[model samples]
Target: MKKNIIFDLGGVLIDWNPRYFYRSVFNDDARMEDFLSTCCNSEWIVAMDAGLTAKENIARGQKTCPKYARELALYDEGWHHMFGGAIEGTVEILKDLKKAGTPLYALTNWSAEKFPWAKKNFPFLDLFEGIVVSGEEKVIKPNPEIYKRLLARYNLKAEDCVFIDDNAANVEAARALGMAGIRFTSPARLKEELSALDNRPSHK
Candidate 1:
């Protein structure tokens, strides 16, 4: 039986960081950090990833912190500028896996509205046999339902998949469901981990 390798898009295959784009908006690093932590935090962004539209997200942010309305607006307007591009080394590994006939799929926590932009900007995303976007499903990672949805929708078995994610909680969730899970640190390390898996009898 061939093993399926599931990948996380942001932080693993793609470089995505709000700070990358926000640095130019806020001159002071400390102030930017404060604004990001207080006004446009991860918790708020996760709501967007879970299916909230950019317009709604911006409106909510504005309501929460009207003083940072300009910054909140930029989150929607300059959203494409947030991506730093593909992690080339990890992309190389993905290509090698494809060349070797391994099945590839992606499970990403991304806004449905924003994902089209990423799909347009990143060519490698086309390589996946299938992808499950959280925003499209109205569920995010670390949630068992989303993972189960991916497996069920694709007719894939948990035991036959190896899930890779940058978040420890997400990785653990995959493991909990009986799939091999890897907590990605760097591309080089990811390559090493996958290589080790390739040598295993189950993967063969």
Candidate 2:
């Protein structure tokens, strides 16, 4: 029986709209994408989130794109925009699930630096039974290790847990680990998926 629900922070719960920086105010997706493609995918920041070097990452992000540093300045600004509050129906769905006595958890590949801002701004996420952020562990999701750790913490069997993430690679990773997963697209679709799960009454 499924007793736990895990969620992805960005895109799934919070809306990650990168387009917010450009179309609304600045014309910078092209620049940001270029920077992300080059230096943003560093393991050092990953290590920072895993609770490694706190000061190192701040310096690294600063140092990574020294030549095109202004692009980095907008990194925080861009993320703030992409991350809107929780999806409209998500808060209500979480409230309903909580009331129904369901066990809910959050598993996100978040940055130690950025998520604090998110937590400060969004409290709905504070309701999870547990939150596993990659930045804290220096290990991101879809990395089988992180999933395994979450399973162990919840004392859950893969079949008895369903994960929802905004990224396809994340969803695939969950399935690869023998768990059920849904790739979240919209609040309505997520609602439908959750509602469908409620109707089925899983047992395993």
Write down the lDDT that model 2 would get.
0.73
**TM-score attained by model 2:** 0.78
Per-residue C-alpha lDDT of model 1 across residues 1-204, encoded as one tens digit per residue: 679999999999999888988999998899899889999899989999999999998999899899889999999877777888899999999999999899999999999988998988899999999999999999999999999999999999999999999999999999999999999999999989988988976423
Tens digits of lDDT, candidate 2, 174-202 = 99988778898887898898778768854
- Scored by lDDT, the top model is 1
My TM-score estimates for the predictions, one after another, are 0.96, 0.78
Question: What is the C-alpha local distance difference test score of each model?
Answer: 0.93, 0.73
Candidate 1 residue spans exceeding 4 A from truth: 201-204
lDDT of 1 at 92: 95
Return the TM-score for candidate 1, rounded to 2 decimals.
Answer: 0.96
What's the true lDDT of residue 61 in model 1? 89
Ten contiguous residues with the weakest lDDT in model 2: 17-26
